[model samples]
Target chain A: MSQDQKRDAIIEAALKRFAHFGVAKTTMSEIGADLAISKASLYYYFPDKINLYAAVLLHIIHEAEQAYGPLVDQEPDPFKAMDALLKHRTEFIIKYYNVISFIRSKHDIPEELKPVFGSVHASELSRMRKMVEKGVASGRFRVADVADMGSLLFECLEGLRMMYLEQASSFFPTPEQFHNLLKREQQLSQIFFNGLTV
Target chain B: MSQDQKRDAIIEAALKRFAHFGVAKTTMSEIGADLAISKASLYYYFPDKINLYAAVLLHIIHEAEQAYGPLVDQEPDPFKAMDALLKHRTEFIIKYYNVISFIRSKHDIPEELKPVFGSVHASELSRMRKMVEKGVASGRFRVADVADMGSLLFECLEGLRMMYLEQASSFFPTPEQFHNLLKREQQLSQIFFNGLTV
Candidate 1:
């Protein structure tokens, strides 16, 4: 296998272990053993566990970008683009909530990895801004400030996501129920968007 | 002093100490000492520190309700009422973020106090619903579901509040910058309300 392929293999193995046992307990040797590689090889690829963990997060982010990036960029209708983006975001959160929760609880996360989160957020914000700009260019949205409106819309979506995560047990007891909650939230967003467009 | 006055005095003293030293470190004895009361007297009013802490949170909630209740109930314009409520909420958060942060970090908070948070949230949600209903009735809002829209609006405000609290030190490094951020948020809400009313 190529060197890059070996590294990707290691990250894929680490992601599963980290998800199952969590970051605190997952070790380099276990990952190395899973890949039938030496610990030295693993160290060569990622000097420490933190670097591996960050790579796992970045991997998820890249997957999301690949999946949703085109929808934001190529959609003809800005509203539809935003709706797709929000739905994609919700799915991403549900799929990786465990990793997200781990990240939230881990205070010792490296500062270098902090920018990954910020960059992801900035990327999303810029996408929303582009959608707003598209809406205005097409005379579909009456937003006075595309950047501010985009940021607000993104923040509102984030707020809904946070509320859902926080109250998942009580408010959304099952997967179907959670899906319904997301649908309702999306409808609510639709109404807000309609208000903007009108 | 009247019984209610004494309880208020105790809550005030506890709030100060809780703000200064946090819930884990603040003791009933110290609070009683500050108020020139016996530990037993403190216990008479509040069975434990957790109970006392709950009272402190409840006191803050009550003060907020008293301050903003009229605006929600008596305002002639639904949009204006919501605007006022959102602005008031931002101020309340800025004023008491330290206490809110302490409460958020205290995992061992009593179950009884959990309802305090719920009640505050529910009260706010209900107020938002009323405003939406009023707007719909007055032909000022084009909402299909008042409750859902109201819930969404409240969630957006909450999300903004959470973002502000989390990023206060970074995105909003100074008070002036934070205030500007809030103002921009308010304008975003205004655009949303305009969209609804139109």
Candidate 2:
């Protein structure tokens, strides 16, 4: 295999392993075994276990960024664009639950590796900023302080996403009443627009 | 020490050790050592490590219940009752961050002890429900679905408390803000109450 192919294999294998076991307990040997590569070959592609872990995380974040990147579009139809972006996000959560969990719990990750992670993180906020600007411009969202709104909205959505992942079986909103797959996407969209409105 | 005193000491030691180092790593003998008791003597009070862990959790929960029980009265004024209950809960969090964190994480808590744990959980919910009923009765609050509103308001508060705990340094919200602990709380609260009338 080519060097790049080997590196890619190592990252994909490591993500699968790390998602299940977490980075602290996952070992170089286990990662190599998952890739069906010799430990020596694994070391050749990535200098160390930490480096390999960073690559895996960066790949996961990059993929997520691509999934939610549409939110940054300067759409004439702001609400529709938002609807699409958030729908995309909810879909991603349902599909890539493990990757999202890893991203959420990345505090244990080294500061040096955050640059790789920052690429995706920056896009999320930028996307929100664009969405808020569009909403304000179109006179649909009557809110000041995009900076605060963007940050708070991100955290609220993050909380909802995490809560859904953590306690889906226990007390998840029923689609018929609260929200299901289709209805959750709808509720989240409506909640953001209406926003504690009387 | 007498048997009851020794048991309390052991449970206290478990709380201290578990809070510092987490549950699985802290051995039963380590707690016994902290309590100045022998392993056999510790076993005399609680048959096993899990049982001892359960005792520690129950003790903390009981302590909190004792502290907050009297505040949960069915008051003539809902707002007053809610204000008092939340104040009591807020104090408990400030005073016993460790024990609350331990309970929140479900650290060392066994499956069978869940029902006992749940009663404590129900009491907390009952207080929120009372507040919602008062809001509806007073007509000061918009009433669409009181049950959902009660739960969502509680979740928002829970989310706020957790954010304050986890990211307090990142976003240092002060208490005087009225709606949220953040600087924007006052404005946010006004917007929530009065709507976008401006």
Q: Point to the candidate with the largest DockQ.
A: 1
lDDT string, candidate 2, B1-198, tens digits:
777887788888888887677666788889888877788988898888767777777787788777666665656455456555656655654454444344443323467567766776676566666666765676666656767655544444444444443344333233332234432323222333233111
lDDT agreement with native, every candidate? 0.74, 0.60
What is the lDDT, from 0 to 100, of the residue A56 in candidate 2? 76
Where is the poorest 10-residue window by lDDT in model 2 chain A?
Answer: A170-179
On a 0 to 100 scale, what is the lDDT of residue B39 in model 1? 83
- Model 1: how far is A156 from its true place, Å? 1.6
Residues A57-158, model 2: lDDT tens digits: 678766866655644384656567767776665565545454434443433446757787567557776776676677777777777687777766555444
Give the clashing pairs for model 1: A195-B195
* lDDT at position A171, candidate 1: 34
What is candidate 1's lDDT per residue for A134-169, written digit by digit as tens? 788888888777788878777666655555655653
lDDT of 1 at B175: 47
After superposing all C-alphas onto the true structure, candidate 2 shows an RMSD in angstroms of 8.1
Regions of candidate 1 where Cα sits further than 4 Å from its true position: A12-34, A91-113, A169-181, B1-5, B12-36, B47-50, B91-112, B169-181
Lowest summed lDDT window (length 10), candidate 1 chain A:
A168-177
Which run of 10 residues does model 2 chain B get worst, by summed lDDT?
B189-198
- Stretch of 10 with least lDDT, candidate 1 chain B: B169-178
